[model samples]
Target: MDLDQSTTVESTQSGSSSSGYCRTNSEISGFSEHLTDDFNSCSSETSSPVSWPVTGRSPFRPTLSRFGAIRHDHKLEKDDKLNDQKPTDLELEMMKERFSKLLLGEDMSGSGKGVSTAVTVSNAITNLYVSVFGQHQRLEPLYSDKKRMWKREMTCLLSVCNYIVEFVPASQNLQNKPSMEMMISRLRSDIDINLPALIKLDALLIEILDSFQETEFWYDEQGSMSRNSLSGSFRGAPQPQRKEDKWWLPLPCVPAGGLSETTKKHLRQKRDSANQIHKAAMAINSSILSDMTIPHSYISSLPKSGRTSVGDTIYRSMISTSRFSAEYLLDCLDISSEHEALELADRIEASMYTWRQKACSNYPKSSWEIVKEKMEGDKNVVLAERAEILLFSLKQRFPELAQTTLDTSKIQYNKDVGQAILESYSRVLEGLAYNIVGWIEDVLFVEKSMTNQQES
Candidate 1:
């Protein structure tokens, strides 16, 4: 009754009796009467009360190929057993939300950007499992349906597993893992190859955003009370007002003197002076702040870490902005509360120092210190900050160069120069804010799953 002895049973169009055919020594498909005999012999032998080397394999003997099939059968059996344990609706919703959060790339628990450590990675896994289990319970309805939505669920599950495999090592220092750089690189490749849906989901999200960008807001109109506080005429109560007639402030006036070459030259010189002043101011600010003491509770409150794309995005962005320090970026992320912000700042600083010691051996070189000083100067903070960030990123990528921070000391500071830098940085933040708001609107408004797809 070896596996090679497969039997095939064929029934005629009239639905007459099914005749079984046995394959003596080849790949065959059909019902084999010996199937039960084979299963009994195999199961009995494996689950034997006593272990011994039999004289010879049974005629209903199991081959390696058959054993593989048996293993698969066992897996199916186990899956069935587990599937029987249905989760509650609330659990499923939680899972869906968790999965959605990961898909959308939001940090489950805030770790402030780039300073990933073993603890952080472990926390992410814990969160992911919790969320997955929750979703599993809620998804019972999908399974209960006669129609096959299981395939879709299976596909999504597989994708989530793949994401977990890619995220875990980085999240947990299971085996003295490499830096986040390598992990991220591998993840990018995996995303491009394995979990393309995540990316498509992201793009689809953006597409939805682009589609709604043109929608005019009533708040944009002149005298639109939407943008203003509830206070009315003379700060009393709400008063009726026409839309177009409200007085709008004119754009800021450019430095006097027309658009002549002389004016341009004067403006440039003024800018240079301003840049110098700004550099000095930044320097003062930098020296004024040194220690960052983060609170544990704040770090605890950040979205629990997960394999979410948002987590990855946060990681990469932080790594990319290494010059500003993790603390600064955490500030930028603007997690729900001020307390969280402070805690994130402390955590980042602590992580940075640890990484610097482990990853960057040669303490701050004189070249780096001098450059840092110049960059701190108010006017030069922009360039200095940019240079530091670039240096940190480069160092992270090439640990061998961790000792060398870029030298931006030669770039003198000036108020105008600093203002220009600040202006540009402000614009970048503003753009990001818009993008985030737009994304939030899309997720909260757009339906991810069709309410009823099978109908039409």
Candidate 2:
């Protein structure tokens, strides 16, 4: 029952120190000698006394030895000698009986010797050999043309199973932590040492023993049979089917519109921060477009001067939120001038998603450029409409950026630019009361006109 522990136990010999646990050949030989000695002692004590022939006891009956002790001692010596010699029919029969008893965890005391024991032991030995060795074909000689031995062998096997079920868990020292080799060795030893006594076990009990080592059952701690106990036999056999393997626990998702208050708060804060950053970037982008188009006199009309050139400051701001890091932009400029703008655009596009991790939405400065690219490639009006809808979504999600588009007025707006800005502006003010609606309506109407000359 204790599936995890080793069954073979190493004991300290009569003469050796117990500190180290190593078994030398000499120690084994000594142990064998000791077993032999015990057998001799028992046999001598149990042997019938040599008696006087005529007077029945006139000449002192040489002290009668106990017959039982003699039988026990003779069995042991027979077993020890049998290990060296080819097992006799009688010895083999004895072995099978003892094997069964050991497996049943029954006391193997008085079973007599016969051919049946030899056959059973032979088969059990063969089975053990098969259990350890690579191939079954090599052991065909033993089982060939041998039927009675096979029957006896079956009993031995059943008994072995029963023995294991009872023996494994009950042996506390082995149960603690047994090695595989030790278990196998003990199994071999039990068959070797207890053969004669296992001859008498019942057939039904033997079958119960055989099922303990079946392959299909998973013997975890919580399984039907405990490694520590064998109070009951296996009620049923394992099913043949295999179950599918899985890596993760399965669970359902949270419902829509069921956001927690803390989640909503976090989302709002994130949206606000992204909007602020996006607004600063767009302000610079708008300025860059203005600087590219507007005259110096038109620029001078707008704002007060400082140490940083307005154009350079605006360029830096636009480039900062654009996508590529400051270091990358500087490197690209230093490396190449021909595709500087396109390179910058690509970098911005590539880096847009990186910032959206904190924002939950991709409200990068390069988003407008992305929209422009999509618009240029678009053939269907519905596609353009969808793009516009997405743009409106961005404006609603990020109000600060929408406000920036309205406040920065250095560049006169085209029809397309005016419509986009007005849409953003309307979304930003929609939740405000009637008074603010009028103000927003007026801002929508107020657009900077682009003349035919400027367009040309």
Candidate 3:
């Protein structure tokens, strides 16, 4: 009768062959006990209820149906498909058009509906420069000869500068208001003081561009004169073209031989004037760009606290006015860790899943659970936004649950959320900067290439 004690079991009403195998009653009892214990352990794990951390009640557990899980998997597959597709030509064209409008002072929205007329003119001027100088073929002839081509290119550049200067007055008088007129008048007055300087700078730039001169003598093959005859001796053989000299060599002005003393003195005076003017122009432009600030309207529209998309607008404006300011803004935004931010975002998404599961089990019948379940059904809700809404709802319903959820998730996830937001803002700023800089550099490089075409 004792289950723990060993006892032999005898077969009843059986043949000798069937009675051959026998087992102890104690061993059989022990095997049955072991099986029962294993069953109990498995049942406890699978069927036992999860306890709420704060409250002792056994809340209703919300289980995801097989169909719902399958739907989620399908959504993930669709997202992967979308991500795998490359951007089409149409998309690239649209992006370029929007960026062009941004450089022309349109807002980041790229609506281009209400831009100012001055901005339109500015865009036209920029487009003209791009169309003319952007072509390599158009500039190839300008740089064919190192010694002579620079003068022609410099002359062409002076004309271009003159065109810009003429447009400056029009650009300043854009608004046509009395105050703007006064401002234009003051700008003209200042230009008058610098007019001499500007003119000298122009002449000096041309001289600098054409400064390289390699002496050459042409031998007159038709001359039938003896070499010993001083009067008709064949001129020294024409000096070979010094193709090795660069076109943009900024050589100092050298007095030409066989010129009068008066002409040489005047040339020396002009050379000094050109140098002084060049220095003055560089200093003035540098000072003007360095002191520039974001417009009042731009700054006023920015958010007083957290990050905003308006920063892109500010960045574009800065780029149009000053490269230094644009670079400074990029530095301030600190966009280099964008990859890290994205990785952290993915980690936060994973952590949020774990938090949601635990929080859902704790507050199964609460209003927060209702919101979460409703949001779960909405495929459009992003993970970060959904997490924010859930947290808000939980705080409203039960503060204890919200605090416990935060404690469980820890601070790393929250820090990543903040960093991700900053990174998003920085990316926008970076994109705007790149587009604007590219446009400006394209125009500038054309001018530079014309002067230094040999290197090109």
Candidate 4:
């Protein structure tokens, strides 16, 4: 399900004339009417939504801010390059944060009656409250284990169903308004759509350890539930009057399902073995992922907003990849049709299983990094001995392989680990490969199925 796509979207809205700007009949007209007859000019920037009515206090002035925004808009309107500039990912995030704090003020709207932004700041805070600290489920850090990887991605697919339901009664003023009516309908839709997807995504993927889970499972009694707090974060959101009661963090959890002695022992043994191998292999800097090298041509091709700052560039890649333009993938795979897209996806999937994509220790840029320190030079003499014995046994089984490719620096070779190391290394490699493949397949299969439905 379109996990990478963002739900929020906006466009610049302007008027036919300066007098008509934002004064046009619409939701934002509520704020326009409040603008005094004393204003000299209006800002025509697209982001001038009704939500933001910058506060002017003793030190700051909103009038100058409006003129500055107008000047900025004028410069953008004249120059194609500047006009097309969009906020970088970071700038966009900051803007969202500012806007999400509930855009309108009582002073600006003049009255809390008849007009309110479609979404208010409370919802945003409430969402933040639920996802991170509330009883919202979060995934574990991405490890090289299939179960662990899936668990992490399960959180990647944010479903409202994952959030614990906290009912907040509407203000007495908004109870009968159309804005409130819209909010109710949207809430119903979100619950209907997201709840099922959340449950299915969890069940289909990895199950979180009960200890690692959020506050209370739905099956728990109502009184046992966590209230107005973050769970499992081991932190607190203390209120003014309730400074002493920081219950959000250090979440209260009940002991959950236990394992049998035999199963527990088996898992403990594997965990210990894996932990030892990991500790020996991983460097302190291992957490750093390989950075994507965006070409100069690609950057130059984008609008000025994308090339302006580090944040912009960082966000550019996210925007480009998150939503398919249908150009990059099709060009890379040399496909234009739904059938071809599906075929290309299937071909890519199969090629990954080949030596080309799953190349062994000797291939260029190998994943043998996990056991490399031990196997390549036998840095850990003890660990290397294990790999050495496994290699020896393999050579014995196929003398020709040992004399040729298996012994050489070529792709088929195995000069690294013995059986134990090989087994452990393979586990890591398989997990990564499958995770990568699965995400791409989700996108491709989705596109293919949509196209198929259209055809029929």
Candidate 5:
């Protein structure tokens, strides 16, 4: 069955486009008329369809019409017209063969074989929606009725899946099922009554389709024995052999001892790249910590009696900085040992406390005196310069130890830790998107239901 063709028919017959729920033809015609006018400007013959030169610059560029039709026009010579007037039986048969090949993805043109199937399926789904709903129409109402929305979504998803199962090669389809299932689960859990969530769901669907298209599976030929009239049992035509029961091909395995020298070199480069990223992150964290100041509200909340104590003020500031610094270091280093991390934090706090005690013992003659001298002499310019230099140096070397450790792990394991970190970030973003969709749906559903109950 031609899934794409069947879907088009179903969507058209269902009155999904004809009903008032869909956009009016005037809105669609207006856009198409605008485009037609633009194309008509570039061509002298307005009555005849304009064929844009594919190779040369032309204002009448080949484009898809608002109604999802290609607007390219081809010029026909006398001989071409004569040939088109009466196609021979052989030519008709050849045309049908080519069409079948194109639909089955046997003739991919420029695209790799089996890749066009996914594109065809995805385009079919997109065109179905575009035709029924038109562009720029709000989709929030579709989700207002949860039962209706779920039924529609499920039908569309199952239809697409069924189409794939029927038309796509079994091996390739099996390979793509896991990713498709993941995308569907995400869509079901995450979609909400909002344009952004709808768009995200659409993108995920497209990605799943692309994953299906990218998989390529080949069958091996096997010989079969057959009896012949003149000869004894002979080998017949070779039949395509089915692959083993593996869902996916195994990942490339490393040697027993370790990875090859080339792999080690590549991993070293990846480790360096990861180290650079870690350094940048640490720098940003340090900058934020250095710029952090006690909030006015916090200061106001402090006891008025002891607020004037220089030692107490200094201690609070030191504690905040030390805590932030410790957390930042632990994060950058990717330290999993909570005990060790806490121990390091405790040491920092202890050092800061000792320093505060010494500074407070000298009162106005201690570090306060140096600050006073700098303020009086140079209006704190020297102090600011020194602070900047210190911060710059710390930022440059803060991730050195962490980077060294990462490099050692990469060498030993022959894996790109940085790439893993990047993948983790992508997963986090996907999770956040899902969570946002769920939150919006929950809020909208509760509010709407409550409003209905109040009205009744």
Candidate 6:
């Protein structure tokens, strides 16, 4: 059950983590007996938390018409060196955009390129989910049809960071905007004001994750029981059973394992190319972020207490599942046996594979189930938001997102675990905008902060 961690990738200076696994125990075919549960008259043991009222900024709007790809480590003042005798049109345009970014080339930093917190935070979200499929051996057949949950979860986490990054002063006063004291004050006040809302969103996120584990979700027309509750578990010798079993359901998985090896190779190559996000999630303590605090330039905007910045909780939540395999599975499920570990893996796979997108996929609008009374002849009460604007946006974007449904009313969605923020095209557009804005602003934020420090 204990796979060797000898070949694990070394952690980066940013402390990015890498998952490791060894030798597939593919010999074990069918599990002892897939536990078929009867939830006919059952109630969930896991109490859903109170619904948190979420207030989200309409994220992702740009201040510029066109941005050029330019990276430079500037001093506190411009050198004004003309490397080019005559700059080309594109080069000139790029320079203009860069000027706007760096307060008209006032010099945002000294020498070294600053570390972006967005990249660092996003990296933590990715690294923390070190699982059997991605970090372990790359299996092809088990991909595409699954693993999308991870993608969705990643989207939401990045969205939060992206939205924050959008704060880079889009002010026309490029010369006056990057004031050391004023900008610092604004960042602190804004983060403090937003902390309560952030906490509410975090609570809602916890509720969303909790809901996904219900047995109700396990019964979609063609689906089977959850691997979280395998009855006959492992055969050879008796494996330990979880003492407390909840509503006959539990899990999260990405189907990256099912894809073809070619696709696997491509994804692996892409992972290393963008190393910015790896620097994320270096710390998950305290709410006050400052030079006196731990050097968390990557997440200086976030409160020391920020758990998810949306990325923080995700790393913690999925860690359970990623560790839910072979020997490590024992730690997750509180059992110690190789066969049971293997069986649990299969059970989780089976359970995870059942969550398909349907045209009428129905989950609750309220994070917790809210009931209505027929007081004063009440009109009606609605639970699940099952009407799909039907991927009106998917057609233009991911037209292939078939077997689909939509839930427009809900606010919870992510790029990693699973759960669309909303089954709307706006979510997609918003995410794209979030990233674009974040990319531009983070560059300015990191560099501006570092150089401001030197100047002060």
**Residue 202 displacement (Å), model 5:** 25
Instruction: Write one digit per residue (lDDT tens) for candidate 6, span 1-456.
Output: 011222322112111111211111111111112112221112134332222223442323421211111111111122124322354675456445433322321224543353233322323332323432233111111122122323333333334422232244333335756633312112223332333332222222222222222121111111242355344121121111222321221211222112244433433332321111111100100011111112233223222321222133222433332322222322444535434443433333222212111111243342212322312222111101110111111122221111111110011111211111111111222122222222223223333343344455
Candidate 3: worst-modelled 10 consecutive residues by lDDT: 20-29
N/CA/C clash count, model 3: 2
Q: Where does candidate 1 stray beyond 4 Å?
A: 1-261, 291-310, 313-456
lDDT by residue (tens digit), candidate 1, 21-58: 00010101111111122212112122322122435543
The TM-scores, one per candidate, come to 0.18, 0.13, 0.21, 0.16, 0.20, 0.19
User: What stretches of model 5 exceed 4 Å from their correct place?
Assistant: 1-253, 296-456
lDDT, candidate 2, 175-204, per-residue tens = 657633322112223322222222211111
The local distance difference test score of model 1 is 0.27
Which of the two candidates, 4 or 5, achieves a greater lDDT against the reference? 5
| Clashes within 3 Å, all models in order | 46, 24, 2, 7, 0, 41
Best by TM-score: 3
lDDT of 4 by residue, 1-456 (tens): 111123221111111111111111111011112213211112222432212234643221112222111111122123334335554676456444434333442124445542223222212322322222123222221222322222222232222122223233342346556443211112233333322322222222222122122222122222344543334221221111211222221212222222234433433333333222222222110111011122344323332331232134222332352543323423443534433433332222222222122223345454445545535543232222332332233222221111111111111121211111222222222222222222223223333443344456
Q: Alpha-carbon error at 102 in model 1, in Å?
A: 48
User: lDDT for model 2, on a 0 to 1 scale?
Assistant: 0.26
TM for candidate 3 is 0.21
lDDT of 5 at 280: 29
Kindly provide the TM-score of model 6 when superposed on the true structure, using C-alpha atoms: 0.19
| Model 3 Cα RMSD, 1 decimal | 38.9
The CA lDDT at 290 in model 5 is 25
Residue by residue across 20-94, what tens digits does model 3's lDDT show?
Answer: 111100010111111122212112122212111333322122211111110111112244454346656754564
Q: Residue 160: error of model 5 in Å?
A: 38
List the lowest-lDDT window of 10 residues for candidate 6.
Answer: 281-290
- Candidate 4's C-alpha runs over 4 A off are 1-192, 199-456
Scored against the true structure, residue 413 in model 4 reaches a CA lDDT of 20
